[model samples]
Target chain A: MDGFWIILSGTLIAISCGLLGAYLVLRKMAMVGDAISHAVLPGIVLAYLFSGSRETIPMLIGAAVLGVLTTVLIELFYKQARLQIDASIGITFTWLFAIGIILISVFAGQVDLDQDCVLYGEIAYVPLDLWFTASGINLGPRTVWIAATLLLLILTFIYFGRRGLFITTFNEEYAKALGLNVAFWHYALMGSVSLTTVVSFESVGAILVVAFLIVPPATAYLITTSLKPMLWLTAFFGFLSSLGGYFLAVWINGSIAGAMATVAGIFFLCVWIFSLIKQKQASIPFRA
Target chain B: MNDKTAIEAHNLTVSYNRRPVLWNVDFELPAGQVIGIIGPNGSGKTTLLKAIMDLVKKSSGYVKLFEQDLEEVRERISYVPQRESVDWDFPASVMDVVLMGRYRKNKLLKRLSKADRDLAAEALEKVNMLEYSNRQISQLSGGQQQRVFIARSLAQGADLYIMDEPFVGVDAATEEAIMLLMQEMKKEGKTVVVVHHDLQTAKLYFDWIVLLNTRLVASGPKDQIFNEALLQEAYGGKLNVLSKVGELIKEKDFPVREK
Candidate 1:
């Protein structure tokens, strides 16, 4: 039963991140997700400190606001200050993340968080946190519920905003010609990434969250040629990584989040090698 | 020329980082002619097109399409940006990209109807890309991709089509095909404005030409504006005296282009 909940949480987080990750990967904004995941640290810490309780809503709001701000800052620097996008991303996230670390250090007593919690959340503790009714009926682990809700929200956002997301990502200039609000779609995706990062951060931790946000989608991107199939394949790879990571962690008696990220990396490597071989075979036959 | 103005710009100036790229440009393109924006590399031909499409901010002046504001007539305008501007490795098939043309202001939240898909297919057929509709954009050659972009613009069903350097890197066959398509569009009374780089083919391809070098040098019918003095002004002293253009301007039969 405990194993079921742990794997379920990881899988839900994986699918959500993977779905959004596909867009980020296609946009060449994969590292933006990583940047947002780290940059929202200060917002997450502040939200937690303000709420003074274990709650998801406040943290998500903080993440959303900070996430949009991070993108806005990146854009401002890239456009206004004439900085290259890569430099803009690198500078923005590092500055915000540094502030988060300072906040944690300065308010160590009030934050009351173990270094392990912030660094790489312990996934094994997921089943330990349970939500119960007033009638004393145990529904399930609170972490699983949070993961499920976040996934549902992301699914809804993707479903309704499909058209806008598609054209804007494919061709921004064309979309601008069509008079579509390109900025809206851009910030919407960024806000969602920030929320996903924080929600998954509580149960799965930062490394695993960043890993799922990029690796599975990138792996799917390597093999698929179109968007629809690429998305389905991303979800499949996300689920596969979760299941494989659980077993791998149990066998090694090591960190679950670490094991999950490692498995995702392994999948990426194997797929990459297999694809290179396929390309080589295809090219050899066509050579004159 | 048609009674309706296709594009009207007055004192249109665009600057990048406070340095004006397009300065005090004034011109009015006719509704049905094939117009070319011709200039040197940094002469702001693309900037002029972008300004007309409202892609860049103009420091002064404004552009009117069909004598109305751009916002009121967006659907009547189709913009084909530089072919190399978008990432070809995008996760979409040629058909998917073409279908985006059928998407509009009103259909933002709904699925494209069967009629839209049929129109997209028809556009692909016009470009000889119908069979390659399902092929991923990443798998296409430069010419094929350019054709797909034209197919998308065709699907737009717009009155005024603005293309920026559409023939920059295409093969000879693709160039011929595209020229034929443009002629067909002209026959159908649709307006086309292209930012052209090749001087050798500019006169033959465009019915009218707007020469630019920071400021507008001249804009008129090709026969009226295709003079050595105007060309010299637009190109500064960079015009090659022994080039084919000089011979053509002198009304001498230059050697036939190698087929």
Candidate 2:
């Protein structure tokens, strides 16, 4: 039952990240997600410190606000300050994450969070934090419910905003000419990335969340020729990686988040090899 | 609201980082004619088109499309940006790309209707790209890609077509096909404005030419304004006497004023 709950939680997080990740990959903004996951660290830390509690709601609010701030800061640095994108992302996330680390270390005695857990999440501990009534009706872990709600929210956004996202990602100039608010779609996408990161950060940590946010969609990119297929394939790869990684962790007695990322990486490698072989086969007839 | 004028720009100026690229541009393009925007490198030809399309933030002055504000006439305008502007590796089929033209009419949150799909197909057929409708955009050749873009513009069903360097890097056959499509659009009483690079072919392709070089050098009918003096002014003496004569040779078949 513990294993079942853990895998379910991871899969939920994976699906949420995977759906949003397809758009990120399409827009070539995968690194933006990386930057947001890290930059939201300080916000999370500040929420914990100011509230004097490990409440999920406050931390999520902080992470969302900081996620938007990170995007705004990156834009300001690159557009107004004339910094390169890489430089902008680098400066913003590192400083913010450093502040988070310092705050955690400074208040180590009071804070239940640690730097190690921030890097590689504690999914194993997820089952311990149960949300139930006084009658002892089991409502499952808070992380599971959070991940499920986030996944639903992400899916809803994708369903309603599919055309807007498609047009914006495919061509911004055309989208602009069509009278669509390109900036709104852009920030809305970044908003989804933030929400997914914040909700998944507790289950999979910041670093591995980047993997779930990028790898599945990237793997889907190799196999699919269109956006719809890529999105469906991304969710499939995300679920497969989560389920496979969970069992692999059980067998090897390793970190679940790390093992899940490894599984995603392995899937990417397999797809790459398969594509290369297909290309070679097609070229052989021409050579002959 | 001048019914005869398709586009009118007055005192238009655009700059990048405070350095002016297009300066004091004034011109009026007539409706139902194929117009060419010709200029040398760094002459802000593309900038002028972007300004008219409202794609770039103009430093000064105003532009009117069909004698009204750009925002009001946006749906009536179709823009074919440079081929190199977008990523060809984008995961979308040719049909999908063309269907984007229908997005303006379909609007957000509304699925493209069956009529929209038929219009996309008919647009593709117009460009002879209907057979490759299902193919991914990345698999297309340079010329085929240009055709697909034209097909997309056709799907837009706009009154005015603004294309930037559409003929660049395309095969001669594709060039002819696009020219025929432009002429067909003209027959349908739609106006086309192209940013053309080749001075030799400019004479044959466009009936009206707007010579640009950081400003409006001259804009008028081909016979009225396609003269050596205007060319010299637009090119800024870069084409010396010999090259100027060479241009005469290239344009010899067409009766050009030697002055």
Candidate 3:
């Protein structure tokens, strides 16, 4: 029962991040998602310092604010300073992440937060943090409920904003000319990226969250030709990675999040190699 | 000609970082005509189209579409940006891209109706791309990509169509298809304006021409404006005097160029 619960929580985290990550990968903004996850570290530290607890709500709010700020600063560096996008993202997130690490070390004795936990979280302990009603009505683990709610929210955002997101992602200038309020859609996507990063990172930690955010979508992208199939494939790949990774962790007595990220990478490699072989086979007959 | 003016710009001046790109451009285009905006490289041709669509801010002057503000006539106008401006590798099919044309007609949350889907199909059929509706845009030839863009605008069903460099880097067949589509739209009493680079085809493709070299050299019927002198003025690469004056104006930090 404990193992099942842990894997279930991990799968939910993977699915939400994978779904949102598809759009980020499509838009060539995968690194931006990575940057947000790292930059939100300072937000997490600040929220803990102020609230003196690991409560999800205040931490989420803090992460969201930094996520938006990270995007704005990246844009400024890219546009105002005329730097390359990768450089801007590289500069902004690393600085924020470094600040977070410094803060954690400075208050090491006072806070329960550990630097190792920030890299790959202790999702095995997730079942221990159960939520119950005042009358002692158990409602499963808090991580399960939070991950489920985020999954629902991410799906709703994608469903309602599909058209605008599609148009903008494909051709921003065309969407702008059509009067689709391109900037609003841009910020809305950034907001979703922030929300996904905050919730998923809480369980999976920085490294695994970044892996899930990019690897599954990238794997899905290689095999699928259209957005609908790509989305479905991404979710499927996310589930496979989480399931395989959880068992691998159990077998090796290693980090579950690390195992999940490794599984996602393995899936991407398999698809890439398979696609290349198929392409070569298709060309062989024509050449002959 | 007493036909209604489709686009009117008066004393339009556009600049970037204190350097004027378009200087006091004034022109009027009649409705139901194929108008070509011809200019040399960096003559602000694309910039002009962008300004009219309100995609970019104009340094000065006013542009009215169909005798009204662009905001008031947005639905009546359809703009096709350069095909090279978009990433062809995006994960969207031909049908998905075409369906975007109907986005304005539906609310953000509402799904596109069946009627909208039918209209998108009809638009694709007009461009002979109906068979490729399910294909990914990345698998398309350059010509097919251009045709897809045209099909998207066709689905817009606007009274005026504005395209920027649609003929660049397309196959001969795609060029002919686009030309036929434009003629068909003109027959339907819809205005078509294109920013064209090839001067040879300008005579045959456009009914009217707006010759520009950072300034409105001439704008009129093809027979009148397509002559040798206007061509030289627009593309002779000897607008040194005008550029010199522009430089002086910029150096002086003048609010407006003394034309």
Candidate 4:
């Protein structure tokens, strides 16, 4: 029962990450999510300094503020300084992450954030710490419920704003010309990504969280060019990786989050190889 | 000439990095006219279109659509960017691209109505691309892809259409098909502005010609501006000498002079 719940929690988190990651991938902002995840550390540390507690709500609020600020700062650099977008992202996130690392080291003894917990999380122990009571049923891990709710919110946003997101992703200039509030959409997307990252940060640490945000959706991108299929495939791949990775972690006596990330990496590698083979096969006839 | 001018630009000057691309470009098109904008590469033809569409920031200029600001008259205008400008492998079908035309009219959070779909189908039909509506964009041939873009513009149902090099890299048949569609648009009292190349077709296809070489060389009826002198000024002038001299200077230490 414990193993089942553990895997279930992992799968839920993976599905949520993968689904939102699809939009990030489509918008070519996958690295932005990575940057945001790293940049949120300062916000987390700041919230702890202010509130003196690791409560979920204040931490999430702080993270969201910094996430939005990171995006805005990147945009500002791109627009005002005429810097290349990738460079701005790299510079901004690295600086913020460095600050976070310094803060963590300075306040190491006082805070609950340890070095090991920051790199790789204790997801297997999540079931031990958090409990959920839904109606008459008692759930083992609170992470599962939180991840599921976040996933549902993301899905609803995507569903309702599908056309707007599609048009904006396809051609931002065109969408703007047609009077779609592109700025609003962009910030909304960034905010949602930040929210997801912060919510899942406990169950999966920042590094594996990045893998969750990137790998599954990227794997789906290899198979199809259509947004709908990519979304479905991303979710499917994420769920499989989570379940498979949890088992693999148990088998190897390793961290569950790390193993799950490795599973996603393996899936991405397999898809990449399959795509290469398919491309080669297609080119063979032309060569002949 | 009709009293209704479809597009009017006043003192349109655009610069990039403080380098002027267009200098005080002023022109107007009478309604229901097929205006061809011809220029050598980097002659600010595309920049002129982008500035007029408000896609590019102008250093000092104003563009009017139906005597109003472009933003105010957006729904009455359609734009078709160059084929090279977009990612063909983007996850959209032929119809999906065309359906984006109706996006301006749809309410927020609303699915594309059946009427919008039908309009897209009808636009695709205008370009003889109704059958390819379901096809992925990358699967389409260059000409077919160009037609799909044109179909998207047609689906906008606007009175003024701005197309950036619709015929570049397309087959003759596709070019003819696109021209016929443009002709049809003109016949329906819509104005079409095309950024065109191929000097020969300039005489055959366009009714009005705006010859540009970094500045407005001439703007009038094709018969008035299509002469050898204007062509020489627009295409032959100092650019050839500058380029030739530049290349020679690159290879040799001294300037090259022709005998």
Query: lDDT by residue for model 4 over B148-174, one digit each (tens)?
Result: 988888888988898999887777799
In model 1, the runs with Cα more than 4 Å from the true position are A48-57, A107-120, B1-3, B241-259
Best by lDDT: 1
DockQ order, best first, reads 1, 2, 3, 4
CA lDDT scores, all candidates in order: 0.88, 0.87, 0.86, 0.82
Residue range with the least summed lDDT across 10 consecutive positions in model 2 chain A: A114-123
Give the 10-residue window scoring lowest on summed lDDT in candidate 1 chain B: B250-259
lDDT of 3 at A260: 87
Sort order, TM-score high to low: 1, 2, 3, 4
lDDT score at residue A1, model 2, on the 0-100 scale: 86
| DockQ head-to-head 1 vs 2, winner | 1
Q: Per-prediction DockQ, in order?
A: 0.72, 0.59, 0.54, 0.47
The numbered model that scores best in DockQ is: 1
- Answer with 1 or 4, whichever has the higher TM-score: 1
What is the CAPRI rating of model 2's predicted complex? medium
lDDT of 4: 0.82
Instruction: List the candidates' TM-scores in order.
Output: 0.94, 0.93, 0.91, 0.90
Q: What is the TM-score of chain A in candidate 4?
A: 0.90
Superposed model 3: Cα runs more than 4 Å off: A52-54, A79-82, A98-120, B1-3, B238-259
**In terms of docking quality, how is candidate 4 classified?**
acceptable
Give the Cα error of residue B9 in candidate 2, in Å. Answer: 0.8
- Poorly placed runs, candidate 2 (over 4 Å): A101-120, B240-259
Q: Model 2's lDDT to the true fold?
A: 0.87
